[model samples]
Target chain A: MEVKEPKRRIPLVGILSGMISVASHLFRKPVTVQYPEVRPYEPERFRFRISLKLDDCVGCTLCEQVCPNGSIKMEKLVRENPRNKRMLYPDVNFGTCTVCRNCEEICPTTAIYLTHEFETARTKNSFLYSPLELAMDEKEVKK
Target chain B: MNDQWIELNIGPQHPSMHGVLRLKAKLDGEIIRELEPVIGYLHRNAEKLCEMGFYCDNLIYFDRMDYVGAMNMEVGYLEAAEKILGVPPPDRAKWIRVIIAELSRIAAHLVWAGAYGLDLGMLTPFFYCFAEREKILTIFTEACGSRQETNYMSIGGVYQDFNDKIIQEIKDFLETFPKRLEEIYNLYVKNDVFLSRTKGIGVLSKEVAIAYGVTGPMLRASGVEYDVRRAEPYLFYDKVNFEIPISHKGDNLARFLVRFEEMRQSLRIIKQGLEKLPEGPYFNPKAKKSMMIRLRGDGEYYARTESSKGEFGVYIVADGGVKPYRVRVRSPTFKNLSILPVLSKDVMLADMIAISGSIDLVFGEIDR
Candidate 1:
């Protein structure tokens, strides 16, 4: 690594160009989107809160095993499926979840998926979704 | 020791400061005499946690390590893990990794540019830079599931393939970003105030930078033609043709120019990568689920990737077990930050903010 001499540029020209750049943007449409009324574009794979489909779940326990932060815990559920012998489903603790998508990736079935709902805030301190609560569809999760 | 010296502490909380960095500076008549960076505020003991989990489970920690450049961080860790496992990702995956890594570099640089502007008492550029960054984040969201902490890269390959929609999105970004980048560049770089605040400020000499183990754009700005992507030739970097931009100034202005040039190079790399992207399976399916859960390897390997900040290297000491025996991260910001004391001497108190911002300190990576 060797040092070379620095280049000299006209400060006046730079300032004028910068001013022109800023001025040009004044005529263009503002990039900011008004929230609550105008929703920003979220891609198809936009991940946020965890949603579970009880009908497709088979109590594989893979989601629980793959959760890095212990956010997902397997609980005994009364609902039984032909594939599920133990009748277990995942209970997601959103308070600890980093939304890393590990559980979704490891799931044997596409039962556990991430919803595109960005607004997961609640008045309560912690968000603990039980087996039945986690089974909410996209529409219910949105609500 | 002199009574004339006044001790000042600027953040673990401050509006202008980047992240949760706390700077303890000793000032004498508005000039900084001595400075020490107080870290560990954002520490999660990530290295220690990596030792407790399975190999695949630890990738998320890398995502959090450098949250802005999560893709690059993941690449570093996975490269080392894959080396030990002796399973290489498919050609398409390698190309995809390159594209994602370069995009992350651009995004991280955009943040640094924005935050740097904000530190220098300019607000408009911050908004402008972030607006540009939002588009890149959308690309990440489409490729991975998350935007900032994208846990996209996986061992033996990436988690998902780039769909045509995602490719089109990237192409759209590529088509529009350069012109927008020029506008943003002209908005700040050529401005009299920005230049005066940055030029010839916090000059890190070549010897001092090398001595302090500085890497990435900081090192490049000091006239070091070293890039891990080029030097190590990881993935498809050797296949791509791009110049390593360097400046001998080693000052804040030089760093800004270097980063701007690097972004252009990154755009070129992404364009080339998209063109050369092969058609194949993204992941090496041979690396089974059981293998991922309980990976057993007996070796120590260190892999380095040029993150947006600098060289984000990961050292893994694996035993014949499910978990790694030890994982050590060579986070670039940590080493780059070590030179703060060297650069801060005899500089104005206000200039201290400019200097620190130029270094692009991320406490998550540093404190980890």
Candidate 2:
């Protein structure tokens, strides 16, 4: 049995091409985005942490209904409003959230939305927020 | 006989194995006499997860199966669900899907090229390849929110519309990538050392490639013109004008060249798709947002899409329920990796790495 050697290319040509390719990029600016210091820009529509506009929430329970990961649950509030006796609002568990933003999109009142604040790392599971806490924060902002 | 043959196990942990592929090879001196590939370390029961969830809920699982080509993975599932429901995506959505899928192809190939170089003892191409892939990932993050594992494509349409910013970034990438690709070609593809290492090593004949059911660039390298995009045109693939790159050599170098040409062709498809992108709703208005997306009737449907790796297919059986009765994924990497033993036969120990790298295995999909 005879073994045929593979066809060879000119080493000079290959060497020059490799050298030239590397040399051209040697002087160009680096493509690395310096994080922490530079804080890479996230798009406006980028889904990160879930946020709620408590005033606009109609207690529809749509966010909870559409959440595939079961991250959002509609819980009845202690203080019932006269306008609607069924006072339910969303409590979000960030641990279970895949951030698919299905809840945000399904919210008919546009009360539920995803903010670009992805820095949600914490030492405790207490980072999870209930609708009451969200509404309280809204009230504080208004004040 | 036992003393003459050395049994070598190459890893579920080795870096060059390209995911958790463990190769058990029987070596006689420096030459591999027999090689058996042991896979399934990264299996996450992706198909089973899909079966338990609604059609919309399965997109994330598809993303995990082939993390390098998440958009294409999502496309496979979406197409399967669309087939079962008898729903067609909007015109704008189809074009957007094509653009996203082709970008993913480029990204996957970039990773392959980089890692293949690394396997063959070249380092610079890895950085250059990743640098370009980062730009593509940035586009993905802007469009779909996540860099990797983007469950962007839905059954009715895509998750979000392609805004002007994302379109502009894609255009910028299209313009700058060719020059970078040329540098990659020069750095690794045309390098003397790379050529010596890869050229003519692990030759798979066209007949053997077909017999082993190899697809994607691997099959194309063996002179087969069978591309899922060209053979069975899906999405806007038929509308676009691009040639399926093929090589006759059927060697490691041939596979590399085929992928190199494919990147160029993908750029062309993206350019054409962008130019002809229609102005309309990105998602179909009729497609319901609820998790319980009931199929029209009880039926079995299969949808195959040309993923970056190869023909990624989704098979679904519906029993008139929101969740599928059974969901099966036909991953390209699985089919492609099956040919490794034949390719590795009688090859030198060092050449085995070259052979494996050329195939471009993603164990996540294979295991799934």
Candidate 3:
């Protein structure tokens, strides 16, 4: 196909206006948040790391069954709830977890929940959370 | 096989090729003699992987398929899955899906515009377009949890409901977005360099586009007014009143104009959807629980949606089991990218980038 040259408009007017428009942005504050120092606010429903309520969990193993990636494994805990006979709580392997909130939604007693803990990266490859570790909040995870 | 003809490979990793697309072009001096698109560099085998998991597990994979337009991708898969189960989402949920999907289209177009500008060596508009895109991502974050790979849409309906805060934020966005859009449009469209670079750069004929199975904005840019939302009318698209912008020019500039107009149309659709927001449950009450577990189906179904890049479709074959027998994606980018060799033939080497960038190939969807 032959290349056709369209009717061209003068660049001077467009160039000056473009420069002025860009110059106007100079006064505005930079939108970037300082990482490792200032943390941005996450919304209430933000899905990040998984947490489980030890008391509320009935050990039905529904969360373990519902997990798509086989991240959740039902393990027997030493200090079990007296209400529960099975004494099995879900231990989530975060290395395999997709954080899709399938377990949180499928939980029978609102036990498994997702916290707004954005900083999930660590030195270790294995991020398996035991029943005790799963019960801790974001503040505790930071500690 | 001329003595001066040189072979050039422009990235599975280069800056301008868009995602992981590599163009193997035969160059006669600066003019391209032949061009072959080398795909599968970013392939994750999402189709085969979908068959391994439960029906619901495939939703996350859909999210990654078209990360820019995840809502549209999810909607396409869910539509196919819902067809097998013989249940549609509730009215409110349908409206919510329409609103969110349109928002995603605008967001996707914004990314395209920013990237296209960057490809053409204009840095100012990229930042401006992304700044506006950030506002849309913020709305997505508030409505659903995540911003870009938002697994917001579910099988029966949506995972979350729209609260008052989210609604208000959308309204605020609708109000401010037009001015920002105009600002960004003026930054580049009026500029002599952007106009000259893109105006007559890549001219795709109407017949060639249709024969190659091109759909969405690219097809519309070639003056083929075929949009899945208008033609097929999925979700609440039939209920909403919107226009499909078409340009007969069929050049890189025409594609840019068509996409920009599409963003405006998306804004219009969102406004209408929000205005006619119904009061009801977001999820289909009957299919909600059963769909999460073993959604056994005996037949095959195909579902297509007007995604940002083009017609994103999902074809599912189920065999009365927990897992799908087979899942195939009719990704529009794949079809849209097929015509690249045709368009790139005999064009200037520099203009090849403009043409390819205008086509908007997301390797995730194209290679999936």
Q: What is the DockQ for all candidates, taken in turn? A: 0.50, 0.31, 0.38
What is the RMSD, in Å, between candidate 2 and the native fold over all Cα? 3.9
Window of ten residues with lowest summed lDDT in model 2 chain B: B288-297
Clashes of 2: 0
Number of backbone collisions per candidate, in order?
Answer: 0, 0, 0
| Per-model TM against the reference | 0.95, 0.91, 0.95
TM-score-based ranking, best first? 1, 3, 2
lDDT of 1 by residue, A26-132 (tens): 99898888988998887998889888888889998888877888899999998768887899889999888988877877777788888887687665666888878
Model 3 residue B330 CA deviation (Å) reads: 0.2
TM-score between candidate 1 chain A and the true chain A:
0.80
TM-score of chain A of each: 0.80, 0.73, 0.78
In angstroms, the error of model 1 at B202 is 1.4
What digit string (tens of lDDT, one per residue) describes model 3 on residues B1-368? 77788988888889997788888889998999989988998888998888888777788888888887778898899889888866678989999999998999898899999999888898878888888888888888888788888778777878889999999999999999999998898887778878889887789899989999988888888888888998898988998888888888899988998888888888999999999999999987664543476567669998888899888888999888878999999999999999999998899988998888899878789888
Give candidate 2 misplaced runs (Cα > 4 Å).
A1-9, A55-66, A73-89, A125-129, A132-143, B291-297
Residue pairs of candidate 2 with colliding backbone atoms: none
Of the candidates numbered 1 and 2, which has the greater TM-score value? 1
Query: Which is better, 2 or 3, measured by TM-score?
Result: 3
What TM-score number comes out for model 1?
0.95
